[model samples]
Target chain A: MSENIAERVKKIIVEHLGVEADKVQDNANFIDDLGADSLDTVELVMAFEEEFGCSIPDDAAEKIRTVKDVIDYIQKQV
Target chain B: MRRVVVTGIGVLSPLGYGHKANWEALVKGQSGLSKIRSFDPTDYVSQVAGHVPVGREIGQFNPDEILSPKEQRHVDPFILYGMAAGQQAVQDLNWLPETEEEKNRFGVYFGSGVGGLMGIINSGKSVETVGPRRLTPFAIPSILINLIGGHLSIKYGLQGPNIACATACATGSHAIGEAARLIRDDRADIMLAGSSEAAICPVGIAGFSQMRALSNHFNETPQKASRPWDKERDGFVMAEGAGAVVLEEYEHAKKRGAKIYGELVGYGLTADAYHFTAPGGTGAKRAILQALKEADITPDQVDYINAHGTSTPMGDLVEFKAVKEIFDGTNVAMSSTKSMTGHMLGAAGSAEAVYTLLAMQNNVLPPTINLDNPEEETAGFNLVPHKAQEKQVTYALSNSFGFGGTNATLLFKKVLNET
Candidate 1:
């Protein structure tokens, strides 16, 4: 289930940001490492909430910065 | 005063993809109108349009051909057609300023009748069904009316003025005329100007249908739906496409040995202020006179006119009256390419300008196909019905009128001293 969550997060980032899938590494930052803007980060959180069938609030969404952050958030909610 | 000349043209029309292809189709009386296939139009009253041909019969339009897949996903279809046509115009001219200084002299002026109707309609549906969070981030940029100019400017690195006109049906013609003024006023040496439209989507059909502006009688025979100057004509058929031309200053074209298709000599614009949807011969007459006066020629000097003639019952009658009043019963030939291409809205004017230019080049007047019965008002004029007429066209005028009572007339004179 955790592996599935990581794969889903990576897929969303790749499709939404139009970045290469391989570049969405665990330590890769959302803005610094993946070229995501403030709006893109917000939308990425929404995508995670929709995909994982969970509601992420503002403070929790703010805490995510990298691919691993999104993967870990989804795993914790699941 | 710098003179404006048409050096190159690019057409992505419902009839075909390129200039020569559209010309051949028009001259041959081929109808690009048929049943709508972009969506299921079974519930709509007006079920036909001049849709750009695609699918297996005609090759699909790969947007990636002009824009990268990521970029293509964000823009509207009108921008796609506009970019393709704009690229073709630049390529046909073989003119891309190599240096940054030269690029600064090039500009773009493009418009659309209804921008991104499909995008708006789809996004509206998604909001109702799937909720607002599902909306794409690119929706705003995709649906803006002026993004055709934005997309083309980005693609060509054009550094001069970027203009976008949304004068409804007259949008394309106004874009061309206004862009010529930019060159004439020394603002830009070269301007890529025209219009593109992809408004045959569900909302476009529904909205126009509500206005009673679309044909309803010919759903069974879509080809005969747009019968300009015929008594049986009901209304105009919606269409989708783009048309573009590279307008360069005469000296610049001559210096570069660019092939000049025709010289744009006069432009006239006016407003009716009468009704939102209705047009009057009074405004059209004044606009026609303004153009002729600027060209410094009488109506007798004109050999042909590409009439707007959208085949609407009221519009055709008033426009024919306007033509008769402008020419005062002269024998100059006039016809509507809309008889074949339907009403392309914003793209209609530029596409018809291309046809008129081609007619001047070849001296072959395209027929107003399906004009089997001339309305009594059209009896004296040579509607050039059912067959292409070969004539020595020295000067020609193209008329485009749109909603909001806007009207534009462009005059082009053939080069007589070319040796």
Candidate 2:
């Protein structure tokens, strides 16, 4: 289940950034590796909210730095 | 100073398709407001508008009437309306100057407040449903403001300075003023100038509703809701339409034997910088004074004033005070065409300009419908109410102010001695 959640999160990141899904791994930083701008990051967070059926407040959204952080946040919320 | 004259006119108003129908309807005092049928507005606050009644059913209009099909699909509805109006204007003048050089000497300047809200809304829905990846490739091109001018330039093969202005509601007047300046500066011999708007969608309605800028009192009585200068006036009824005019140098138009409607004498633009969405009365007064000054005409010389009266409670009052200040004590014939057509946003300036021009041509000022009892806020002005007025309109001024505290006023003089 953990592996599947990570895969789904990676797919979302790659799709949002228009990057290769294989390149968006757990350690990949959204800004540094995926070339995502501030708006892209915010939109990514929104996508996460809709996909997981949970709310990510701005304070918590600020702490989400990498694909791994998003996965962990989703896991905790779920 | 170089003189600019309107050689041709075209419109796609709610009253009808062409200029004749629109002019007749205006003269006869016909209201275009109806129940919101384009979309379900039951959940929304503003439930009525001057929507294009047959837009969808008209589907994929013959671009040969304007341009080829391949070129038509790339632009937004505002641009489509602009192009169609521009085509009509060009055709009416038989303005196909024989060589490519003449084509290069003409340009297009158009405006739109919200470029392609329908396109944005449709693409946004796709993003919400099938995810962002399913977004169409034409999304960005269809929503940009400048593409209206770009498509017009391409369609007419115009190579001169083609530009688009987005001054919210003052956009059309700004476009016309800027295009006339180009003629004054000897940049272009002729300019296909006007504005278009197609923001009558779900998101468009919802955004305006959220701002409390639309009428919510009349779901059952849509026509009566847009009551300018009336005691019961609540708010403006949003409308969608476009108007275009062919502005050419007076000598050039005469040489071509084009029918000259009137000479565009002066244009004035001012910014209140006071509020984001509301008008400051003093700022509008300055705009009107500047226009009259630029036209080198006295206040009493003006015969008719086409008001920017959006029928909003505050907007109508501010404009009334502005007109009062400009005319000082003289009672100029003033009427808000928006009372009948509803507010057409960026296109309001040009639409009102067309009405002003027609009024000047026929010597009849169209009525400001729905003004039952003039409010105390709107005092000491001759607001032409209920019925059209016939008068020798030598000089007419049109005012349009927008959301960003932008204001534009245009002056037109009837051509008395043409021979």
Q: lDDT for model 1, on a 0 to 1 scale?
A: 0.88
Expressed as tens digits, the lDDT of each residue in B1-419 for candidate 2 is 67999988877767766677788889889898998888888888889999754533342234456644434544567777777767767776677655777887898898899999888878888999978654555678878888877877876788888899999999989999899999999999999898989888888888988888899998799989899999888889989888888899998988868888899988898999899998884678888888888889999999999999888888888888778766868758999888888999988888788889999999999999999999875566778899999999999999999998999999999987658
- Model 1 iRMS (Å) reads 2.7
Backbone clashes counted, model 1: 0
Superposition TM-score, candidate 2 onto the true structure: 0.81
Model 1 regions lying over 4 Å from their true place: A13-46, A55-69, A72-77, B55-60, B416-419
- Each model's lDDT comes to 0.88, 0.84
Q: Model 2's CAPRI class?
A: incorrect
As a whole number from 0 to 100, the lDDT of residue B60 in candidate 1 is 37
